[model samples]
Target chain A: MRYGAEILVYLKEGVLDTQGKAVAASLTRLGYDDPSVRVGKYIRVEIEASDIDSAKETFDKMCKDLLVNAIVEDYTVKVEELR
Target chain B: MRYGAEILVYLKEGVLDTQGKAVAASLTRLGYDDPSVRVGKYIRVEIEASDIDSAKETFDKMCKDLLVNAIVEDYTVKVEELR
Candidate 1:
């Protein structure tokens, strides 16, 4: 199966998103009006695997072991099979 | 043309992502291991428009006015034409 997975990761509320705020400021400087902003990450990965189970196992492990950091971010994965 | 656009918004480096961290914890509790997490947002928009310029205008406006809050995030858009 062709494993195409999209994962979205985001910071918890109240976490200071200095980067996001800075971007907002830049936007205003560039004449764009931005009232609020939330920053998050999105990743799309295509994997070569056997089935849903293996895909899940690999992705789940990847996310836990490398993709997501338990200390600063959370992630969710949506898997799609293309074959 | 069928306008398919994908935009990714991310916090500048040094920005804190609290929500992402929380999710990492949840994953760990749920039996996943996470090391470091960075949170950002990804948006995919499909618009029925005339051409690239129009699609650009619509998306640029949407990101500035609605999709991205200039105050907290930086966004870049990629457009694909589907006929």
Candidate 2:
């Protein structure tokens, strides 16, 4: 079976986000209220697996091995069977 | 009131995603199956607004004005009141 996984990787709390800060400043300068912003990566991947469990397992390994930076980032993943 | 908005920006259909292609190729080389991948941006913003509708409106303007590349990318945003 094939599955689709959506992975969101974000910086850990308390970590400085220079990009986000810059964006927020821009918005404020553009007349929006003082807004707080955080930026992250959203990755969608299609995987071939026998079942949902194995698909999720593969996603976990992918995150740990390559997708996420464990030292400063955290990730959440959701997987659904692709019809 | 305070509101939180989550925005996802992705390339339109048929747009070439070089970064995604590179990551997918690396994953395959690292023994994962030939998975198809798409990469996007996830932005979380906190805004001060009177209501959810206004918050969404602000988000729309944000996307149009600065957050998204309208020619090659599309975006979806969801807003919820912050407690």
Give every prediction's interface RMSD.
7.5, 0.6
For B1-83, candidate 2 gives per-residue lDDT tens digits of: 99999899999989999989999999999999998999999999998998889888999999999999999999999889999
What lDDT tens digits, residue by residue, belong to model 1 across residues B41-74? Answer: 7655665777999878877886876567677678
lDDT of 2 at A13: 99
Candidate topping TM-score: 2
Badly placed stretches (over 4 Å) of model 2 are: none
Reference interface contacts recovered per candidate: 0.21, 0.92
Task: Return the interface RMSD of model 2.
Answer: 0.6
Collision count for each candidate, in order: 23, 0
Fnat for candidate 1 (0 to 1): 0.21
TM-score of 1: 0.53
> For model 2, what share of native contacts is present?
0.92
Count backbone clashes in candidate 1.
23
| lDDT of model 2, residue A35 | 92
Please compute DockQ, using alpha carbons, for every candidate against the native two-chain complex.
0.14, 0.92
